[model samples]
Target: MRKVFLFIVLVAISMASYSQKRYENNYVSVVVPNGWVVQNKGDNGLGTELMSFYNDEYDANIYNFGMIIGFNQFQKPEFLLETQMNLKSSNPLFEKATFGKMYNSSFMGKSVKATDFKTQIFDETFKGTAYAFNEGGCTVLAVGSYKVGTKSDLPQIWRTVKWKNIRKDTHVYDSFREEIEAYCAATNKTLKQTPIVSNGERYVSVYLEPDANIITNTYKFVDMEKSSFDENKIEQIKQNLRPILLNILKATAKNAEIAAREMKEGYIFKYTYIDKNDEFLFSVKLTPDDYQ
Candidate 1:
């Protein structure tokens, strides 16, 4: 009976030692498994804040068992996922990394888009999984990487996340996107009432399409045959209109708080002009250097 009681005590102690730790912020609450330590916690400077964890034993040399959680207020899940993937792919160390297809999956009680990836750095080959989902106004992304043959508890850790303050309302950025679309439509209607250019080119339409952090303003033009403008003439037109477009963009950015904030946060402004038949004329992309 004493031996049995001692065995029960030992089991209790072992369970206590291996218990998980919970971490929470305004965006999400998650569990970090035993043996893993927080490696880093800070904003990534590209509009998302990140927290990283790793197991000391498995990540002794290279990052064998590691996880990262990122939160963004306005970006969509797809945008956040693409941004994270691009950041990783751009790194010189991951040049040879291969990615698998992204598929729908459930993680942390939310439907998410998940992908698998593999990369080799030095003598270690690391396999990883990443997923992104939206919870309330926040877009959350989680990534886990482990050595090829190691037993990782990342899936268990992911299942422990609990989203706080759930809501079904549209995100702030989505509302802003609707406003911008309406504004563009109004501008297009006004432009239609007058000549868009002094050279008899009529305005076809003005539309906005956003991809990740880039906001594109596409201007459609017609009556190109009347102008008889070739490539050289189009180039000259673009050069002449560059400052005018820049001025308009600057004014809009100055007047709109979200536009200014987004610009400062490295959101790119792209202006594209095309013919009515959808033939590309030219495009000018403005980066932070040009805007700020």
Candidate 2:
């Protein structure tokens, strides 16, 4: 009877020791098994390391997991994925690694792009997987690595991650884009690219440009195959499109007032016309004086 009681106590203690605990930062939260240490490394250019965990007992065995949340540049999953893959491939340690096919999978309630890799390092086989996803203008990446034939809790750990809604301000570029898109849709004009807001300046592009029939508002593309247009022709095209571009600026002024006010000073707007190949044909600039 005493042996049975002792066995029951031992089982309960083991289960308690393996239980998980929640860890979180400003951007994300995740559950990790007990005895694992979590570290947060704030803002490393590429992204913010929200949480990274490793068990001291398995540290020598190469067992670990990390999650990063990115907002400044490389916010797209495809771009992030490419950058990560390139970094790994360039590392001398993973020179002979075999990367697996990329696929879409659901993790932490979001669709993610993921891939697996295997490499041999100093007679020890290492296996790893990476995942990326974009949410609310931020990209999140989760990676896990372990030595082959070793036990790993990464899969169970990542499945319990939850993203926090922490972005309080919308990007000014998004506002400019929305207003420009609405104006383009109303005017039956097609935009060549999304509006870009950088360094207190906004740039927009359209598919058509003013030609010889500028008086009639008839737009066409220049023959780039022949040769690039001369300086005189380029200047003339810019002059012809000036009024039309100004009108677009005026039309979106009310909607973009909030973004402009945020800039406070030195706000410039540029509209460019591009060819089918996305080559720049001509462009016009509107200063605060022109838009106000």
CA lDDT scores, all candidates in order: 0.58, 0.52
Candidate 2's displacement at residue 41, Å, is 1.0
Residues 151-210, candidate 2, lDDT per residue (tens digit)?
776777878877887553344335543433333342232112122232222233332222
| Pairs with steric clashes in candidate 1 | none
Whole-model alpha-carbon lDDT for candidate 2? 0.52
How high is each candidate's TM-score?
0.49, 0.46
Total backbone collisions for each predicted model: 0, 0
* Per-residue C-alpha lDDT of model 1 across residues 1-292, encoded as one tens digit per residue: 3312321221111122144778765456778766665433433222334455555523344344444454444445555565446544322223456778778898767798888888775557888877888766556677777777777767776677677674433343356556556555655553443324423344455566654556676666755542466879888987888788777668656543446666767777787877767778888888788778
Off by more than 4 A, model 1: 1-20, 44-47, 57-63, 89-96, 166-292
Winning model by TM-score: 1
Clashing pairs in 2: none
RMSD of every prediction: 17.3, 17.2
In model 2, the runs with Cα more than 4 Å from the true position are 1-20, 44-47, 57-60, 72-74, 89-97, 120-123, 166-292
